[model samples]
Target: MASSNWISGIVVCTLIASCLFVVAGIIGIVLGPHILQSQVEKQLPLTADSDQLDSWSTPPVPIYLQFWLWECVNVGEVLRGAKPYVVQRGPFTYLEHRTKTGVYFNDNYTVTYRQPISYTFVPEKSALPETTRITMVNTPIVTIVALLRNQSAKTQEIFNIVKNFFNETLFIDHTAREWIWGYEDPLLKAAKSLPIIKDLVPDDHFGYFYGSNATDDGLYTVFTGEDHINQLNNINKWNGISSLPYWRTPWGNQINGTDGSWFPPLIGKDLQSIRLYLYSTDICRSLYAKFEKHSSVLDIPTELFSIPAEIFLNSTLNPDNIAFGTTDSGVLDVSVCRQGAPIYISLPHLLYAADRYQSRLEGIEPDAPIHRTIFEVEPHTGLVLSAQKRLQINVFLQPEHFIDDFKYISEVVLPAIWINESTTIDQKSADDLNNQVLRFFTIVRWVSIVLIPIGIVIFIVTIVLFKKHRSREESTPLLFAEANNTIASDHDH
Candidate 1:
């Protein structure tokens, strides 16, 4: 009787435990995503007030800039009938201060924020000299002066007249120049005193000019005006009901989505292509950027690792050769992006352009992966954990029929230099995000997987044990009655 009672108690305990496990498993599977989403939503910056939004926002992140300068070592060689060559120089590092200035809601109730960005070169952190000179070899005015230096006095006078005409038409004097990174060579320097060239080049101070504090001078500045984010608020139609702007989806969050939405609250396995219209300080324009449809979903490690270069290459950010104004069939007019100069934008390693843009030049390794920009993003929070923003500055050089020396030069876009601005998440932030968020999800996933199977096994075992115990209990009474009857018959005999 005691053994039977103990068995009955064990079965009851097992059955109750099994039911609880099964219930927990089902709850996790069905409601886990909703619960997690709720937690994320609570942390979102939905309030219009700056202080409230700032409380939930991420702090300013540092961007480290490194410039790979290509020094024209063979300029003298070119003068001696040899093809010009360049040697790659230091990765000059600069610390860029980036921050979201403030948040406010527009008349349409769209949340908008200002990002104030500034940078200063850190000489101590760099591998190159603070003041290095690069010859302005490709500038039309400089090249024209060099070509006419040996001509007769009459030829030079005629060239001067032609140079002045071209300068006014091309806005050559007003063309943006980076004095910090480039300067005119001695040959071009002597020609600066010529009558036609006296007022062509702006004062040295003008070379350091950036636009008003909030804006940079370029064609794309129009896209990044005070009301930039408003342009991205595109209405999404769904099932005859207009949903909120594509940025704010049924998920109640903004994420890097299609052309209309370029921020993040990305969730699930939808590997759709996202478009971004970002203003480039270098190119001075707002570029139409898009990622390739097939992006690699990486399994990010807790520790820092090199990001794949293929990610940026596959993105359709770089303009195709057809983007240049070509008479060829099926060519697109990308002239709006050109600001008096042929603008060629590229990824860190010069990965995307056709033969016209010479990326595989000297100082660039044949297979150096470090030349490519790297990016590590926390998908859940939409935070950039680490990034290397690499871009090469290029100029499309075309021959001028008037200049004698230009006949020998092939029309191609020449790469001047590339810049890599890299940043990594500080240790403290990495630890907090990884330990608190990522690990929690991992633990919950594993626990749910384990509990369901264990619960089912325990429930089955409990049922089997209960059946055996009941059978034994039912047979006990029958056996006792049979024995009693046999004994009674013996007594009668």
Candidate 2:
């Protein structure tokens, strides 16, 4: 009886252990995905306590700013009614740094921040010095002329008087620094006195990227993802406004995207079908990036997204896109957004643009491999693994019927400078992602996979052992009765 009880106890213990393991396996299989997703979501929000907040405010990734300037070579011949001959210049490279300041957490699951960015010249990366001269259009003179295109003839006459006073030529020699930073001109010196030119320039000097260093873009209110994880990093408001007044249509004005720096965790969502939105404060507009191909960074699986070339197409060729003008078939008019400046934007080397515009220039080359904007995002984490935003700045040097210098100058889209701002994840961040997130996910997955099969095997063994124990007890009952009777008789005698 003692031996039977021992065997029975072992069987019961085995059955209980198998039952517990099966329950654990079922729970893991059912709830594992949710737990992992929760963990990922926790790390994404921009809360003060979160580790990712520091990465967003002060990114560890190195950002590079590269420029290729276009120089008008035959300025004398171009002034005599000939198409301008152009030459492409060096990649004047700079290392850019950014920091977020004046952080304020809002009550409605959003945080506001002011970002200041600066750039430093990198000699090893640059092809030319800051003092390298570029022969290009006299931008202030051309800008004033284009600004007065819609003004009354009386207003034009007043501007003509100012132009004569400045005596600025259509084409002039300026250093790379002057073209990139700010250069003083006589007409812009009186910009305060002239109402027409006042809004176009921030100060007496005007350069493409001159006055932007160490300046905060604006107040940005971004989602913290407390309520919904997908909404993380999305700009709820920019400069106290939910939308911009720069573009022509309502759809164009919506400020619905992240700050182009960080993306929320995607987890198990469909990446290929989803469209990523990026809001660039510099452009005062949001661009949608569509999945182009499968890519990888730091050996992490990623999806490559690019701004659709359709966005660059004009109204007629791409009728669905109403953000740009109907006439300029290949340009993005950032004039209204840029304080009434006649600033036309395009892809570097006139890439993804109308062929006619590219054909109009002598040295401009529109190659996709070299110039397209690229964003490599890790699919599961939604982190920007690597990114390159390339753009070209062009000037509309149209012939004005009223101006004598422009009479010989034909209507042409002139390329001034092209820029490429790019960044990639550092190895340390990649290693952290692997250790913290990817390793946890792997362990959870293996637990579910191993536990289910092991639980089933243990259950099958328990059932077989239970049946054998029952059979042995049933067969021994008769033999055990006879033995018990013999023992009782002996005791009576």
Candidate 3:
């Protein structure tokens, strides 16, 4: 009896433990996603008290800026109305630094800030030294002449007189550093002496990114995510304007997107669930990206999102751009926002561009694989792992009948320089993500899947043990009773 009682007690305890395990497994399976979601929710909001504050104020990753300038090889042929030929020059790489300054938290669940940006030349990364000479079309002069299409003939004549006096050619020569940074030009100064040209351009010197370094682009107001998590990092206002007046349509002017550095959490996993928009102060418009393919970086799975080539296509192929009539494919006329300089933006070498652009120029090649902009994002954390932004600048050149040297050339776009901005997540941050977020998530998922089978197996074993003990007890009942009667008779005697 004592032995039976010990066995029965052990079986009962085992049965109870099995039941508890089964219940725990079920609970874990049911609540696993919610728990993971909750963990992500705590980190999504952009607040001063939040864990991302330091990184937000100053990006932890290194950003690089590279310029591939167009050097005209056949200026003589181009001037004589032959197909304009150009060759690509150096990839002048610079380490770009950014820091948020003049930050202010607003009461309306928004934060306003100005980002001070600077760039330092990285000699090791560049293809050529800063001293390499680049000869290309005089963009500023051409731009001014283009703008004078509607000006009085006297104004055009005045511009021509100045152009002649300065001995400015259809193309100008400058060193790589002067082309990328700033170089003084007498034409820029002499043009101001003309009454009509006085207010045309405020810049006295010209470069691809002149006045870009050590400057704040604009004031940005972004949501804090305290009120709505999806709105996190979305622009609320820029420079006190709700929308831009640059474009012709309301949709084009609408300023709704993140500032390219941050994105809303939890949506990176779903390609169709949401679209990502980036509002670039430089471009003065919001551009969207579509999920392209599954990819990985730093040994982690990621989603590759790329801006479609159609985004740069002009009026004919892209209906959204129809307001600007019959423009070249892969042309985005941001000239209205860029000091009315007839500057157009495009992909490097006009990839996905119409054939006309390529036919008009020599020594230009469009490689689809090399020039597309992409963002590799880790899905679960909704963090960007690597961002590569590429864009080319072109000047809208037309025959100015009123001005000499410009009259012989047909209307075309002169390729200037393409820029690439790249950045990747640091190793330390990737490690923290694995340790703090992914590891816990993986554990919960595995535990939920594992415990169910373990609990069921133990439960079945306990049931078998219980039946066997019951059968043994029933079979031995008569023997046990007889022994009890004998003991009672002895006591009576």
On lDDT, the candidate that comes out on top is 3
Q: Per-model C-alpha lDDT, please?
A: 0.47, 0.81, 0.83
User: How many backbone clashes can be found in candidate 2?
Assistant: 1
Residue 435, candidate 3: C-alpha displacement in angstroms: 2.1
Model 3 over residues 198-290: C-alpha lDDT tens digits?
888677788878888898888999998888877888999999997889877888888977877777764424686556888987677888888
TM-scores vs. true structure, each candidate:
0.65, 0.84, 0.91
Residue 59 displacement (Å), model 2: 1.2
Q: lDDT for model 1, please.
A: 0.47
lDDT of 1 by residue, 133-198 (tens): 555344544334444555566766666565455442211222112433343433245345566544
Ranking of all candidate structures by their TM-score, best first: 3, 2, 1
Worst 10 residues of 2 by lDDT: 320-329
Task: Put down candidate 2 lDDT per residue, 1-493, tens digits, no spaces.
Answer: 8987888888788877877777787777778867877777776777878887787888888999998889999888788778778888889998988989988888999999998989899989999998999999887878777777888878777777777777767888889988897788767778657776576455677889877888877888999888888898899998899978777788888987787666776556676777788887656678888888888888877788888787777787777567655545667777776656677788887787776676666777788877888898875567898999888888877777777578788777889999999999999989988897777767877887788778778879978978988897898888899999999999999
Instruction: Estimate candidate 2's alpha-carbon lDDT, on a 0 to 1 scale.
Output: 0.81
After superposition, the stretches of candidate 3 with alpha carbons farther than 4 Å from their true spots are 1-13, 267-270, 323-326, 464-493
Which ranges in model 1 have alpha carbons more than 4 Å from their true place?
A: 1-20, 46-60, 111-113, 123-125, 132-262, 272-281, 284-324, 327-339, 359-368, 371-374, 399-410, 435-440, 482-493
